[model samples]
Target: MNILRDVSKLVCKTDRRALASLLKYAETGLKPQYVCKGHMSLASQTDQNEDLDKLYRMVEVEVRGNDPAVLKSYSWFTTTAAMELGITVGECWTPRKANHERLTLLKSVHIYKKHRVQYEIRTYFRFMQFLRLTGSTANTFLEYIQRNLPEGVAMKVTKVEITAIPSHIKTHSEPQQLELPATVEERNL
Candidate 1:
């Protein structure tokens, strides 16, 4: 008889606006241009727009097993794996403060056991990296997980699913401006 149950979903949500701002700042190297609105050539702008759109995308991974201990270990290992791959990972906290407080208290009071594990990859580059690393196949991803299972832990991964979620945030490219100092003193300043 099957005794293991799927765990509650663990999601990692990204702030699109913040990510856009950071990307903009990184490209322009000027704080003022971070939020400035502008545009570029159609072809180049389309590419930039695509990249920006990707920044807010997400990839959901689902894994199932029959042993809570093994599942838990696998979850922890995958979290570390994501970090090792230079991916950003974070828990999605509830919007309400009261809910946060209640969740914290409840979590502290009991140890929840889960069989199914799910998490999200919230960045475009990281998601691409994950696909590249895993050979862009469900079997490969499952094998990677199975191979990395905690030393002595053994569990059958009944299913592994990967889903790509597109970004809802609209993106536009901003114009880049550079100013040259005319004098040595101005350049130093």
Candidate 2:
């Protein structure tokens, strides 16, 4: 099977608004100050629109509009969009003191799948570099974190499964294998 072709379908084209909002939520972790009017109208739908609403509230601090309903309908659109693109919502991603503040640090990625959907339950070591990742778990992200995490970094991980059902568990055909990077730098956290 052609792997690049399979993966490019998801990576090349993504909803810009949704991606932007998700990234912001991962960074700041705050609710929105903007008034998204669509939120109230679509409160019942458990889909992408809802995910956007929730993420906007946390990321978009500007006054989006005065409509209270719109503001509320802005819900968690992350899970749906990520699944369509074969991605998961990454957790526990943070910037740390690394490389004289030029890079970010993180731990190994822990991914979860359920009901043929994918949402990331892993950490991101947001650094600048080109890397390759191929597997169910986010081993690529971990590779970046490991490679660029300066001389020292600290991360903590607790092995507790989340209550929410994973999105891609049903589709996995067998046990997975991770093609990890050859060099991995360790940190204390």
Candidate 3:
């Protein structure tokens, strides 16, 4: 029994280390064996770099996949686009089921204007890119759609879920209302 316990502990330790190494790769795109600089074959280093590149894309997809806000944006945009084309849309996963899933993706996007096709949009984060394309904060996602969408298209969002998504796109609009109203004492000053 003591021997069994020792062996079990060893197995558990090895498993933990393995998990740690994978997580380290996921976070920093580093491979465990290649961490220390030493004599390694050029082929091996190339293989490790390729593996790291795949891991980084997977990590990015995983992060964006599990984000509810990102999923919501995806759903909103896909649903809106589908509605415009008279295509039916349904939830890919329930809120409960999504907790265990690695990715939440829209299965279909049927566009009937300027292009007519029914197919899968490659990534779940496509709408996140669309929001960025519109030069809109996530807070103003609906507003951006409202302004940029074709003449008859529209989208609506609830009062909540207005948290910002970081964007670097520049728009031509001028700044508005940065100055604060003067207080009585401040006015005297």
Candidate 4:
């Protein structure tokens, strides 16, 4: 029973170390070749690097409106469109006043209510799919937004920006072997 308990404790410690190493890799983007007793083989590393090289594009649309309700409706419309197009829609940022100046009492209150909202639509694709996303595609997306805008609201698209995120390719090399110190019991033995 004592031997079994010691073995279980050792296993748990190893598991914890392995999980921590994986999490470190995720957070810092550092590729760890040795995990516990297992080795991240060269072929696996190459495959992972290849997958990371894939590109993703993000489309940011800026919309301005005077009514919060209209902006909410537009947000829903854009989310539905992104789903239909098989893309991901990021959360809309809180609407901010387009003009920051304090309004005088004589000025129209309507001018002070102007707000702007930004939406991000992201799509991940391979080389061929990326090629399919061209200027016409953006135009089509703009036309869709323009056509679906809620009525009775003075909403207008301020700007549309598209940017691509390309992964940094790293050269693959052999990982140095780390020497671990012996456990207390092993050292005593």
Candidate 5:
């Protein structure tokens, strides 16, 4: 997902004014602080200018939820998985019948017509890696998600199904085996 590059863009490219202020402070050896000027804080100023409240809402943080870190980590996992799958990361995704929040741990990947089961399996394992990286237990993550689900919400299965193609010849077609000649010159034909 190139986390470093994306984060760098957010920090360096997007926040140019903040960068300039910091640079000015560094050059002058004076703490350059933006006057409140009715803006709560410099950070808030930048956020307000960019409509961060709306952007943060897109992140879908549940105010009632205790650990905001879970939501943040879930967002990271979704982005990483989407990048690995070569799909554009959206504000949300539908893993199955469940919503984005329900599928945060990605207990199962939904199968579709013409979809590659192998790729889905790889993505699932890689998401497990992300879960571990985010200080979550890989084995218990699904159980935890299940426990946290709201009342009356049924958990949907995410297993990918694969079917094997038969190698047998068709019964209606007569099997014609090719015969090779013993001589090299004859084999060429």
Candidate 6:
């Protein structure tokens, strides 16, 4: 099993104590997270680098397919933008049933308005990125009907599925958020 899958499964097992163990295991460090969205959006890196210190990918991906190079490049750029914006784009590859079997990501990008810190808005998640290491990977992008896209921002989703299926494009806007109620986590069982 991939280290992240194992880690996520382990973290999901117990309650209060498990979270502490997960923190030690993940070592996301105690440094304060960069405040955005009226809350801590992302934390500064544990190890300092003179340049490009705040954001480093915690996952490594491997892809095999026949597609336009420009499209692939565009996807990468968008994903990076999403990361900067604090979108909870799962660092997962295709065959999604397995990736999201227990977890469903309700990810979005929210701008702090006055602040230019484009923040990723994860509606909810079970784990952060698995781990950055050696592995063969696929795409596990999701298609959503963007319920509430604020403005001046565009949502770019993965254009294809791992099984070579042509997934439809989806965009979220204000109207959709009106439908779904807020997350009720305590009663998940």
TM-score of each: 0.25, 0.16, 0.19, 0.34, 0.19, 0.17
Q: Which regions of candidate 5 are displaced past 4 Å?
A: 1-91, 94-136, 159-179, 182-189
For candidate 5, the C-alpha RMSD (Å) to the true structure equals 23.4
The predictions' CA RMSDs to the true structure, in order, are: 26.0, 29.8, 21.8, 24.0, 23.4, 27.4
Superior by lDDT: candidate 1 or candidate 6 = 1
Candidate 3 TM-score, true structure as reference: 0.19
lDDT of 4 by residue, 1-189 (tens): 343342343234547776665666656766555555653432354456453222235455655555556666677777677668755565466433343433324245466635534443322111101112345565676578768866644433333334454455554487689876679886676
Query: Which candidate, 3 or 6, has the higher lDDT?
Result: 3
Worst 10 residues of 2 by lDDT: 53-62
Model with the higher TM-score, candidate 1 or 6: 1
Comparison by TM-score, 3 against 4, better one:
4
Q: How big is the positional error of residue 106 in model 6, measured in Å on the Cα after superposition?
A: 50
Model 2 reaches what TM-score against the true structure? 0.16
Name the runs in model 6 displaced over 4 angstroms: 1-66, 92-189
| Residue-wise C-alpha lDDT for candidate 1, range 5-53, written one tens digit per residue | 1100111124455445544544665432222223222234224444321
Q: Residue 64 in candidate 4 has what lDDT?
A: 50
What is candidate 6's local distance difference test score? 0.36
Query: Over 4 Å off in model 1, which ranges?
Result: 1-56, 92-143, 146-189
Top candidate, metric lDDT: 4
Comparison by TM-score, 2 against 5, better one:
5
lDDT of 5 by residue, 1-189 (tens): 242332244344556666565556556655434522332333443445542111111112121122334544554654565356443333443232222232223334674444332311111111211211111222234454445544333334232222344666436466688876989898687
User: Per-model C-alpha lDDT, please?
Assistant: 0.40, 0.32, 0.38, 0.50, 0.37, 0.36
